[model samples]
Target: MLVDKVAEILAETAAEVIEPRFRALADGDVSEKAPGELVTVADREAELIIAERLRGLLPVPVVGEEAVSADPSLVKAVCSEPAVWLVDPLDGTGNFVAGRPEYAVMAALIKDGETVAAWIWQPTTRLGYTAELGGGAWRNGERLRRAPAGGGPAALRGVVLSRFMPPDLRTAVDARTGGIGTLAPGSRCSGVEYPRVAEGDQDFTLFWRTLPWDHAPGSLLVTEAGGVSARLDGDPYRVGRDVEGLLVAADEESWQQVRRELGLRPVDLA
Candidate 1:
């Protein structure tokens, strides 16, 4: 089974710490970790819970958002380890501090740079997604499978759009269909949208930048749920030090159609 029970613990603990402090105050005591990055008590506390749990459960190593940014080698070593965990205790800290319920607790187990198991939990929504290599994906206790996307223009059916997408890409997408419907879900919540792709709620996801922790867990869920998960270049995605890439996941036909529409290349499928 090879599932890491500690990941479940991390998700549960992170959710517990996050929901209460989401919008504890208007001030929210926000701080800057980098020029453009933001942080809060919730992020640090959640990371602490996840990192401690990983240190106890795994003999390898962990790469977390809050505590390890100062040490690039730590991230590199963990990403290169044959077995490691990529964690984003609070994926959408900015949204959390802004009183949004879209943030989530994300964890993924990687072996040989490939994701073996993943869990993404939204504490406020109480929706949890989990996937094991070949066990299929599940939400709560029920298994999930991709639903049909009607053979109409993608834009007419409320495609979940990405924020700050380049103008040319948006135009090309819109030209292939009608105006995209208002279904753009934010990425602040862990791996929420990946399951949405599996559930047929979100037509596709286009990410210009996604770290190991951001996509690892949810990508497994999407594929296990009878959808496709791969880089924009259509290559098998591998988690590594600061490796950022684009992804698109959907039902087989729609996935292919979207890739063609976007002029994307195919990856070697497993």
Candidate 2:
């Protein structure tokens, strides 16, 4: 199956390109793609290796993070192409550069603007997660079902990525978070955050930026595991769309609970 092939490719690339450079980056190996946005040699090399292998397997447009960084127009393929591969070669470049083990390699297969299959591989842990549109999600080899919703709004534990949110919205979210059980600043890696939410390690997650490579894979994983993922306005998440404020939780009930607790209402981003 194509999903299986893609999974193998991600693992192989992580082993051959990503893992070796974990803390071995030279002075010239890392550079800023934008102010404060870092990219490393491993990110570029791994994206090339993964993109090539994916194209070889299916001959489709492969929109990788590093590639899109060089040419933003490449991302348009996600909506225009019949089938496209969205790849994040090194998800947590900052963490990896800092010698932290919280990074991952992530990819999602989008067909007709919807995610069909997804994969996330954490090199340090040798853990791989895959999810198909209807085949459900799995980790390593075990099937995954998000833990049942537990506790109330005050007991909810979550990670909120509010860095990109507008000042007023950020302050609003911060003030509201006091009602939740536990809140985190996020791991700075959607690849890691998505799986943690799916497995119930965290009750929910909120993101202001809706980049396809970052959210596509994880969004499918969480939803396929019997969780809920949608825009803050409660719209279903669609790949390649321009919107903001995503809230993902372990289940529908928890989803609504968090939405209400956070005082989130639908906003017209248009």
What digit string (tens of lDDT, one per residue) describes model 2 on residues 1-270?
Answer: 887888999999998988888889888999999999999999999999999999898899999999999999999999999999999999989999999999999999999999999999999888899999999999997899998677888888898888998888889878988888988778999889999998888989988889899999999999999898899778778987788889999988899998888888886244
**What is the RMSD, in Å, between candidate 1 and the native fold over all Cα?**
3.9
Clashes of 2: 0
For all predicted structures, in order, the TM-scores are: 0.83, 0.97
Which ranges of candidate 1 are over 4 A from the true structure?
Answer: 1-4, 25-28, 148-152, 155-190, 241-245, 263-270
Candidate 1 pairs with clashing backbones? 234-267
lDDT of all predictions, in order shown? 0.68, 0.90
TM-score of 2: 0.97
lDDT of 1: 0.68
Instruction: Evaluate residue 191 in candidate 1 and report its C-alpha lDDT on the 0 to 100 scale.
Output: 60
